[model samples]
Target: MTDASTVIAKPVSQNRAIWQQFRTHRGALFGLIVLGVLAVVVLIGPYLWIPEKLSVAEAIKLKNQGPSWRFPLGTDQLGRDMLARMMLAGRISLAVGLVAMTIAILFGTLIGVLAGYFRRLDGPLMRLTDMFLALPLIPLLLVLVMLFRDRVASIIGPEMGAFALIVFAIGITSWMSTARIVRGEVLTLKEREYVLAARSIGARPHRIILRHILPNVISPVMVSATLEVANAIITESVLSFLGLGFPPDFPTWGRLLFDGLQYMQVYPERVIWPGLAISLTVLSVNYIGDGLRDALDPRIRGR
Candidate 1:
């Protein structure tokens, strides 16, 4: 007896309400705008300046130069244009964040959903997650990178090889938190009336999980994904700073930060450029995640 328009209108109203809630959070709104601008610049800016590719080697005459019309950002110790370095670094940094988060989310969600939905799998899987959680992250990362970096580099080329190893290291390390969160959410959702109803009808476990459980559990997964992006970026930065990440010639924001530290006393702009990019990118992602969390939760959205 319900009208089609009524169903459509309800969803439209909810979407509008969520948008309004997001917009009202001033920090979140600013973050959305800033992130949008950053995405545009990093994705499109490189192509616009065909003469100044981000990967080009340094110009010796421009070495250690300050901000000028020719090089608005400045030149680094190696004479590579700082602006170009930044653009290219952003590409690598952003890619690492996204890809690593995706891998973590996949592993975490699979483990979480299985453990939470099926009682037989809960103890063992959760114990496995805990074991991973207990390991010291930095030491494990160092060991893994040293062990596999050469082999991976040879297979995938140096830049991509390092990239794969770093992403895998991060993905493996970072998924524990997501698994815990998703498991808890699934435990709660699997007990809800709709799930009970689905079970009562003799629905298969897989069908119930796919049709009823996953949709309800997706909000937490999305929030976790946003936070994971920031975590991945910071992890990559740490590796690069330690000289264990990208190839020497291949610049990443973290590598730039490491290189600039020695000259911090002299041209502070060297540090400033890469440092600002990392900070802004991470901060913006965090704020956007905050807004998304509030927007997605009906209880929080109204308040």
Candidate 2:
């Protein structure tokens, strides 16, 4: 008679063990700390205080103002507070990155798991995934943006429309890598003794996948997700800078870059701030992803 308490405790104990192992990786620990700080800043900084509404006339005064006591980062061409706008923009950029990556990860994991577990589906599914992989993402995204501009604006309103488009574009394109990674992991895991045991016990396919396979495959998925966030963010910035991103009324980091590019010769700092923000955020995310990969893989740890 298996004790229910013991059965529940086993999973909790296993989770704790994994966490303990993860903590031992120094780079991952550092990355976590940095990411935590950045996340807090992005989430809380905008809500602490509100910026005064500047009429188009009043907004003209601070245009291209360099770093000073009044404005820490400086004012943009529109006279909007650079620091305030940067922080505000961070919210949108980060949100899109996380949400888009989450969509990709969820869909990719589902496809990968199904394909890997059912051998008959593997060839066709993988080839389809390969097709997406083969297509050029940036050009496709540009075409989609142009083709669906009016429809997207009507659906989500101007403020959120561009963000949503960026998310969809990134999510659809980014899943290929995740699917490939998850497929490989699932293939190896599905053949393990525990999976065979579960099958022998009359566990349904869904139950076996959920209970036995998902746990083992989740580590790589997590690493992929972290890295994809950075990719998505960069993609959003590129789109925005090309004047295809969020409308002027609602600014994002990429939009700032676009606005700043005009004044780069007169006030280079306008371009610098947003560029730095994007670079730093992406760099930090990549570092964290690297850490997660190292921490999650025993082979890397052993090496």
Candidate 3:
């Protein structure tokens, strides 16, 4: 017979249990490792391998050279060190994705929670969401950029202004889907016993949402956040490819792709590097989202 002390199982905290479930997903584990490694490289690699500080003549002399011991990724047409540029570009790309996703998640959650909790407001708020959904995303982005890019650039200087506009554009356009998902979840949650119990106790709407609704809905929101990051990165890349993003001098992954397009025939690696980076980053984020969805769901967490 087992001793009572030995038979008794210690309880696991919610966070610890969730982490255990998350770790069980091999794809998620791999994605997390890859993303962490990339983040470290982008953060520290630039200092070790400085990019494009050579004099104009010296830079010109190094143009179009293949990778060597000095330049591990080869020099671009303008003779900037490819490795350094890549690190800098990764920083910007990741920043854009994270910041934009934050904005989208915040706004979407607000809209979703409000609409889901208040039956009186649901029709109008959902209709508004529908209106946004009906709009063509790419065309709207182009128009927003064309109309505001020059004015914003003049006010804040080109690089910062462009970053702000792109982030804003992607954030607003991407929130609709998240809103719909969250709203659906909230609608189901609000009718649950705990939410109804909070209502009976004279808790305010805001308090009820904060204490009960948001916590319950976080799983889906996290999944949406991951997808938003991937989408924002791709959108930024497209804008840069079209020459509508950051100025030519400020390197982003997308801009790097555009610059390398001309040299593709002679030095295909120029395009391959950035393209591969974008694809792998997006793929990793998608895997992470898939894992989070499974780990966060009450029904699936243990199974």
TM-score to native of every candidate shown: 0.92, 0.89, 0.96
Arrange candidates by TM-score, descending.
Answer: 3, 1, 2
| lDDT digits (tens) for residues 274-297 of candidate 3 | 998898899899989988988887
- lDDT of each structure? 0.88, 0.84, 0.91
Q: Give a tens-digit lDDT track for model 2, residues 98-209.
A: 9999989998998899889999999999999999989988889889888887788898786777677778888988898899999999999988999999999899999999
Best by lDDT: 3
Residue 135 shift from truth in candidate 3, angstroms: 1.6
Could you tell me how far off, in angstroms, the CA of residue 149 lies in candidate 1 after the best superposition? 0.3
Relative to the unseen true structure, what is the C-alpha lDDT of residue 299 in candidate 3, on a scale of 0 to 100? 77
Q: Which segments of candidate 2 are over 4 A away from where they belong? A: 1-26, 299-303
Error of 2 at 104 (Å): 0.7
List clashing residue pairs in candidate 1. none
**For model 3, how big is the CA root-mean-square deviation?**
1.6
Q: List the residue pairs that clash in candidate 2.
A: none
Clashes per candidate (backbone, < 3 Å): 0, 0, 0
